[model samples]
Target: MSQNLYKTDAFTIEYIPGADILKGDFLRCKTSDEYVSAIRAFKEAYERVLPRYTFWDNTRFGHIITPEEQKWTDAFLNYPGAQKGITEKVGILVSQDILAMLSVYEIFEVGKAPLRPGFFANEKQAMEWLTRKETPVAPLPDTKPLIAVEWDADNAKAVIRMEMEAPDLPYYLNRFKRFLSDHDFLVENLRLFQELTRRERKILSMVINGLNNGEIAEQLFISCETVKTHRKNIMRKLGCSSYSELLRFGLFL
Candidate 1:
């Protein structure tokens, strides 16, 4: 059976109250072109989300931080709130393959000694090292793995779905935010739209802006009864009987 990767909340590190940790992804690539593409994508994402995070590029061996990057790290390190808190510490991971190619100076900058930042061969190791001081993370089941979703949009609305089995619901939701933002669909709130015919997406778009059933009916060009039926289906599919519960799903409209 496929194990649930998300269910390991106890093992996953949580953001400290005021510490802003930005995840910079660097996936393994088989070819130079593939590596270039991954680098470009990571760079673009980092720049776009810079305002919200202290970005760290995780590689195979350790983190890659430069003089230019020190400005962001310094700001967070100097923040009174972060300084007084234990959650402000941030680290990076570099792949073992990439580490072998680094120059002595570059490797020195990333390794211990002058730079106290932790290094790891993989993300799980990096996160474990970073969070080791507080509590030891449990061993992860090799079976269950993190899953990704792809969303498709149609005319002002997006249809999102997934197929992986998960152990943690909240983590998957949090992970989806990057996809939502990448597609420019991240919004404040969402509501159950439709249950049958995959109308939940349309309803989410409408409800995120506080649309009532009648308004949704008009916008969707359906009768009030039909809209109600759709709502019922949505509630059933989502396992939520109340509008409040539905909104909490946080679908970006």
Candidate 2:
């Protein structure tokens, strides 16, 4: 059985008792205020209901999140009492639009949130994944030291291990920063590609394939200095700090 927790012109949220999950279906674009209200409602219901409820978000008709809404969501989820240990898992089903998928991906990558989230293209797969029981691990001995050092005869190297009962806040925050930074590079790369001239795209394609500036210049019949200038402009436009970063971003190309 499912019960309606909240509903509006833009969205509907329901609690599915059988699956122990909250389902949020977005029907249309929403204003910033509406979006905030919806999130608040979801949080309130999450607290009021049983603990460890999975969240199934269906955003086939949802709009992209604005920067302001994104900030608010980050703060809300990170609030001390907001969602600490209440959610078990989150499964998000996104629309066909790439931008819509990216918007939802941004939320998951923000991190430090209580939920373990995964994105999916369909509801059935999402549900199956959410309901699957993970193999349990026995708890570590409390008497173990925080850090242990051992000699590995096979590798002929000293191995150091730092054990923790749970991941610290800083761990998740750093992960969030890395995920967002990498995705930001990819997004910028796509935008730069769109802004590039035909000749520039050709040069960028070569660069992505590991061509040196001099090689690109020779192949394109351009001056070496001109190739260097083009490379500089490409880096600037894509906001990549190093050639390696640019190469990683090139995967999207």
Candidate 3:
């Protein structure tokens, strides 16, 4: 058997073969806990055991909306090695009932690009739909012109949504790439933040939260002396003399 890639998060466990989907409250992607667990379960069950993972996403049904929803979707869609078993992965399922909740443009695109091939009302119907081979229709043509792109400097986050027709897609995407390049500082900071040791980051986070040595120790289940040591180490690594300064520089970026 292949070694499990995601043993840490509970979310990943659901997709594993023989996974107890009952343990997962799969109503929707609400919390990080759910996302992490579902990801782990799915990774082990579907992708690892079998050679194909047949699943459905309810995004077209208006299930997902927030950025967190988008993040988890991105994770599952773009997860490393998750596609090993998936030859023809499905992206969205648009039903007549769901169509009423969305727009004409939305349904049109779902019927065009980004829609799953075998979209049915239920999983069984979907499986049957997938069994019968059918040619996928090509994506709709884009003929709109480009305009502008914007990002949130304070949050160091990018939002690509804009009001435009389909033809402007190419220019809009090109502008998005340029926006990403222009915000190199935020990107570098995010990379460094990810690279930092978990404990180090946790300690820095606690310090930024205005916790004293004892409080930090209590929260982390470590001793006060250990908390002091971690504090000093964090300050040294971050090159900050005071907690306020560290919070200002380290947390913002």
Which candidate's TM-score is highest?
A: 2
Candidate 1 regions exceeding 4 Å error are: 1-19, 51-90, 98-117, 121-125, 128-253
Predictions: Cα RMSD each: 20.0, 16.8, 16.8
TM-score of 3: 0.31
Per-residue CA lDDT of model 1 for 1-253, tens digit only, reads: 2111111211221222233344544433344444334434433443443322222333432333444433433343323224333333345443444322232124323333233344334556655555455532223223434455555555555554554322122233434544675445323322222333557667755765798889999998888888777777767876777878767555533
* Candidate 2 residue lDDT tens string, 121-228: 567767776677763121122443377999999989999876542212223334556789778866756766677777777887899898998899899999999998
Q: How far in Å is the alpha carbon of 249 misplaced in model 2? A: 17
For residues 1-253, write the lDDT of model 3, one tens digit per residue: 2233334422212232442111122345444555555655654555444533344443323222344544444455334433343434342233233222232123223232243333333555444444445554322324444445678999998776555542233334445655675477456556445655789888877777777888888888999989888877767766567756577544343
Candidates in order, TM-scores: namely: 0.25, 0.50, 0.31
lDDT of candidates 1 onward, in order: 0.44, 0.64, 0.47
Q: Among all windows of ten consecutive residues in candidate 2, which has the lowest summed lDDT?
A: 135-144
Give the poorly placed runs of model 2, Cα more than 4 Å off. 78-83, 114-116, 135-253
Best candidate, lDDT-wise? 2
Worst 10 residues of 1 by lDDT: 2-11
Ranking by TM-score: 2, 3, 1
The local lDDT score (0 to 100) that residue 44 gets in candidate 2 is 76
